[model samples]
Target: MNAFTRQLPKLMLALTALQLSAPALAQVKAPADSSNQVVVPQVDRRDVRLPRFPSNDFEAGLFGGAFSTQNFGASAVGGLRVGYHITEDWFVEAALGRTTVSDEAFTRVLPGGIFTPGNEKLQYANLSAAVNLLPGEVFFGRDNAKPSSVFLIGGVGTTKFNGQRQQGFNLGVGMKVFLRDWAAVRIDMRDHIFSVDLLGKRETTHNLELSTGVSFFF
Candidate 1:
């Protein structure tokens, strides 16, 4: 009986140890599962904005206005301008045009005492540099929008009439109303300062012009 009792206690101790060791093994496997599990962070993308495109390039247009000269009479002036963009805000423009001026209708007595009427016509061509005070996008708007822009121009060129030539300076301000991405209508006002020699005497003339035209860009 004593031997059986001692053996039974030994068996109980072994079973208890086995129960404790089994829980420790389960704890090890639990940590292994936790290590294998992954937590991934979700990411979100944001929209990026880009800079606007510039309008520096080639352009062409036609313009007309009224003009008066010292030697010539008052007339209508018409011209065409071809321009190249030198920078984002500057351009070089060349123009070729003609002005037809008429003399004031006054009764003039000739050496033979006969009444006569006099008339005169003159033509001119000019070149100029223009500075854009606003960006092209501001004038033409975004890729699919409409806007308005203003510009100032100054230039020096020559005018020829009836085998006579005069040098002059042109100062102007213009506004462009953009109708589309590559087209606009423009209006401009200018003052021309010129000098001429009449009968061996020098004379100064100031001519004012108001003009409207179509501007095309590529």
Candidate 2:
């Protein structure tokens, strides 16, 4: 009987320990499951954007000037220039003009000695590229008001004196006073350097010109 009682107490204590250990094991297993179920955040990628550049426009103008030769007489001259704007500050121009002078001295030495008065007419044409030292708007003004701008021109072309052809180079420095948006008045000092064949005499001539004209820009 005593043995049975002792065995019963021992069996009850074993059962109590088993019950406590079972709850602790269950708690540990629950924590492990929670750690595995934790969520990780995901990141998204995006594309970058950039800005665009500006575009420039085209422009043109017309002008004229007076000319004088070294050995020949001096006279007033007129001309037209057509230009294309390669940039805001640069252009290419083609110019054509005419001048008239008196050759009384040359006529006096004629063989007939009949006192012939000589009258000579001259014409010239040039193609040159010009660069604006300042912005065209600075001289011609903007949408608000008119202004004045300065520029320089240089080029190589041909000039005709009577029936003879001469290869030449032209240079000019000028300024434009803008009266309106599309129209402006310009004055420039131009030099024409050329080699001429005068009566089989190869001579170099410098033609200096002072001119004023109007320009229309588009």
Candidate 3:
């Protein structure tokens, strides 16, 4: 046999041995943990709930906003309110309101041809039922920062004006922005309807009130 032929078998064995050892040499081994070290598994975050609404139960508040008569334009109005939450979506409340009027309101604004005196002021009291019409939360910013609730309120009561008292009804919409478990900011807009008699003439009138204030709840 030739010399090349004689060395072929040895060369084949060396290549086979290298191929067999390559995989073992290429393997990576993790460093062993020390005896005193604790090994822990990875964890995931869990969901959580937020704080309760301020007026989630009983509530009391004060507000000062704006007032408007059907014919006399807009004026300033203010009021005090107390309420109870019968449920998550229902609330019972009572409010006392005072509004100012101008001389033009009596002379040029009385409906149904009634002529009124220069009414000094108008005062009202109402017992109202409110529903969380859209109690859903509002999220702002990229992270959806804060949430608030909105409601609708309506009811009937009495009004005193120009030395006379009469029956009246009101419908209002409001919002509550919770800052703490016991406090919130309340903003409201309301329309009040009542009958007025001036110079033997009677007619219905609308008074719109808007107010904002703080509320305390328990």
lDDT of each: 0.74, 0.75, 0.83
All candidates: TM-score? 0.63, 0.63, 0.66
The true-versus-predicted C-alpha distance at residue 94 of model 3, in Å, is: 0.5
lDDT of 3 by residue, 47-95 (tens): 9898976545889998998888766677788889999999988989999
Flag clash pairs in model 1.
none
TM-score of 3: 0.66
Whole-structure CA lDDT of model 2: 0.75
Model 1 residue runs over 4 Å out of place are 1-56, 70-73, 105-118, 134-145
Best by TM-score: 3
Ten-residue stretch with the least lDDT total in model 2: 53-62
Model 2 per-residue lDDT at 22? 95
**Sorted by lDDT, highest first, which candidate order results?**
3, 2, 1
lDDT by residue (174-202, candidate 2, tens digit) is: 88777766677888888999986656688
Residue-wise C-alpha lDDT for candidate 1, range 108-213, written one tens digit per residue: 4234221123444455567899998964544233466567778899898887754578898889998887887678788888878777664466777777777889
RMSD for each model, in Å, please? 9.1, 10.6, 10.7
